[model samples]
Target: MIWIAIRMLTGDRQKYYGLIFGIAFSTLLITQQLTIFVNLVERGASGTYNVPNADVWVMDGVSRTTDVNYPMPSTALDRVRSVPGVEWAVPHLRASASVRSGDGDLEGVSIIGVDDATLIGLPRNMVEGSADVLSQPDSVIIDDVGVTRLFEDGRSPIGERLELNDQRAVIRGIADAVPGFTSQVTLYTKYSQALRYVPGTRNRLSFVLVGAADNVSADELARRIHEQTGLRARTRDQFARDGIEFIVRNTGIPLNFGITVGLGFIVGVAIVGLTFSLFIRDNIKQFGALKAIGVTNAKIRAMVSAQAGLVGFTGYGLGVIGTMLFIWGFSANPFFKGFYIPWQIPLVSLAAVMLILALTGWLALRNVLKTEPASVFR
Candidate 1:
């Protein structure tokens, strides 16, 4: 029966392929778009997630009290270091200045200052340059994606120098694809090198990055800091969560994707329903012949179900392949953060789509069964 179903669908492209193509493309677009959208929210949160070991982040009191970038008292950093479970503490200075390069002016760079030892929470997976580059008084590290500002031809070479804030600094090394939340073309510099661009201060940092031992909870560390010094602290994990919430709840991302996924769902049902109904009309003669050949109505219904399952499973496999190819292509683009399909999301989507297709087939099956075998003989 299965072999017959396969041969029938393979031979009847005029009847089946149109339906298959329509269903497959809808699935592919919805899956890829939704998958990329979710990943963007997660990737946007990455800078906050990188320092998983940090139990707390101490913020300076300025702007909104919740603003993470405002500078706190430098002495507050020492207070965090002395906390019982605290292993080490460092300050992170975030400054933004227009960086002048021979190529042009680049804006919204995240200039980070870290203590010589702790390095203000640099991610371990920096692709280019050594961690020691921050130790240099004027040296700075920039991600390869942002290196385009330094040279017209992006992949020019290593050690090409650029002028920032009218100050001379050497490119220590290149990191990969770390972007600022607001700007796409962004760069990074040393904490002290960044100070050269700040409005007034030359030595002070913006905020502090604190590290804690395995024994500490981020919440506990946060409380200890407030109790001792009355400063605000944050954890990397909490930052990731807040960042995602900020983008989705505070921005248009969630609303936009929600509309897209909703449309996809509606189109999916429409495609399956219309195509299967037409198929039932075309194959009515076949169903009638089986009923006349000593086949019970239940047996004929079973055959119709087998055929729908075959079409649905085949279309789904093709859709997933097409979606994966789309993902690979988008991952390489500089503006895109690559596509990631998590286990739970795609799994649930697949189940929902299949169930929808099944319901569509069942409706067509009802109409198909009612076509009297006697009418075909007449």
Candidate 2:
């Protein structure tokens, strides 16, 4: 039956060839776009600014991890220490402000401040400078990309002493991390520097980052801290999941943005279906001849299904190759610095596309089976 179906479809080379390529092209586009969108959302949520994998985190009264809009009073550190299973809690301040490059005018910067006591939250793998460089008063750290984006490769603005508010500061180091996947280049400074830059704020810290005792469970500790302080304390794992879910649900990503990609897939299926139907419709006489030879309706139906599957399957395979190339090339390009392609997404998404292709072939098969061989005799 499969061989018969293949022979029937290939009998008309001109008709199904264009349909084959069109379906393949559609698959390539939809798969690549969906892969990018999902990868971006996933990376953004837990990439950097991501909590270190540990027992628990101590933040302000806010329940959501990304909603660090309010300051976690510097005094929050002391209270976190008293909680059992807390090995240590690091304190830091984070906010955004404008930068004066001394080039022309001030630009925007997302300033993050951390203490020497616990810079664990950072990516820790130094691309340029040491984490401890931030220990010096008014000393700052910038990523290589950040420096280039902000001051044209640290030529003019970096290293030079500048005024951040009333306080004098110097760019001491360059670093990189995954925090805020698409966040602008930032200025990293000490807790004191952050205090000075963000004025009209309490001298207290914003949040306490707690590392739990190794022997004990983090969940128990998170529960304790949450109960005690009326503040939210989440483990690093929870934080990452919450972060991804937040972007997916609140940002209308999986529902709205993803639907467009889904439509692309449906269109691919339709194109393949129409192409098969066109050939079947055009060859009513051939089908009639097969029927006249005592071919069962079920066999004819299977033949139709096998033909659609053959074309769809061939197109789907080619689409996977093309989509992979696009994913790799686009992510590596300089223009897509903020965008990232995680390793897991492509493998999973490819599998999904294959399954969808099979389903699409099944759908188009129904139309093929409905063609009556007797129509050709009339």
Candidate 3:
């Protein structure tokens, strides 16, 4: 009996193909859009996450996100380090400055100053030279993304020189750091080097990246720092969340992507509902004939379920595959760098496909069940 239903469902190549296309297109739309949305918003936190050694970040009370932070007094670092349960603390500086490229082009760049002694806040991975190269006189490390932007002609930036804040800086290394929201050129230099590269300010310390002592939780350490120093302290995860929330609250990205996803759901329902209904209605006589034989309504329902299952599986599989291919193809592009399809998104899309099939299948089955066995004679 199940075999007969499978044959019937597949026999109508037109409706079968239509149903698959509907599900596939909807899944592709929802999955791909959501993936891009998530990666894009998360870019705001890339700076925080790139430094994996820091367990806590202490900044000015008014500082919200990494990019929008206000520099704290240099004493703030000492205060944070003095707190109990604080293992170690280092001063971090993030400031923007205009740089004169080798070709005399003026470009805005972000200057990140890591600890001069420990180099604690530098990115863990290096694409070119070792992190130690920062010790070279007037040396700075450019992020991989910045390399492409600063030297668009595919020239090696290792020995390139740039004038920053009227100070000459030589690129000595390439750090494999994630690009921030603005995709600005990022130059990593020692705390002392950054001081010269950026215009002098009374308070040049943007943040104090801290590591919690053994047996000390990051949350607890942050709380202690906040209470003792009267500074805003956030755990690494908490700060990352703040970055994402900042983007969500300030931008229309969430609303825009949400609309696209919602439209995908609606399109799935409309197309699958209409096609499934028509397919069932056209096969009503066949269903009536089976009922005339010894097949009960329960058996008929199972048959319809099998048909929906096949369509759902095939369509969902194809849709997910398509989405994977899209992401993989663009992986080399700077815009899509680090873009990945989270496991949960596919499951979410699967649930949506099932819901679409269930609703449409239920509506289509009602007519078949009510038809009399003699209706086949008409």
Off by over 4 Å in 3: none
**What's the best-to-worst order under lDDT?**
3, 2, 1
Query: Considering only N, C-alpha and C atoms within 3 Å, which residue pairs clash in candidate 2?
Result: 48-178, 48-179, 49-179, 72-206, 74-204, 74-205
Across residues 1-378, which tens digit of lDDT does each residue of candidate 3 receive?
Answer: 899999999999999999999999999999999999989999989989888999999999999999999998888888888999998999999999999988999999999999999998899999999999988999999999998888999999989999998899999999999889988999999998898888666988999999999999999999999899999999999999999999999999999999999999999999999999999988888999999897999999999999999999999999999999999999988778899999999999999999999999999999988989987877
Q: Per-prediction TM-score, please? A: 0.87, 0.84, 0.97
Rank by TM-score, descending?
3, 1, 2
What is the C-alpha lDDT profile of model 1 across 1-378, one tens digit per residue?
456545655666775886677567667766777786777777556565544555566775441212245555567667767878777777666655556554555554555554565565565557687777767656777765566544546574256555666776566766654444543443455555566656554336565677667888778887777677766566667666766776677678878887887787778778878877887787778778767776777776677677777776777778778877777787665555435677666665677567767788788888767878887798
**lDDT (C-alpha, whole model) for all candidates:** 0.65, 0.66, 0.93
Q: What is the Cα-based TM-score of model 1?
A: 0.87
Collision count for each candidate, in order = 6, 6, 0
**Residue 78 lDDT, candidate 3, scale 0-100:** 80
Q: Following a full C-alpha superposition, what root-mean-square deviation does model 3 have from the true structure?
A: 1.3
- The list of candidate 1 runs beyond 4 A from truth reads 1-8, 60-68, 104-106, 149-152, 155-157, 180-186, 200-205
* Candidate 2, 87-201: lDDT as tens digits: 8877766676766765545666777767666665555556666888777777877755566677654374446665566566688777655535454666777666677787765
Residue-level lDDT for 84 in candidate 2? 77
Candidate 3 residue pairs in clash (backbone atoms < 3 Å): none
Global Cα lDDT for candidate 1: 0.65
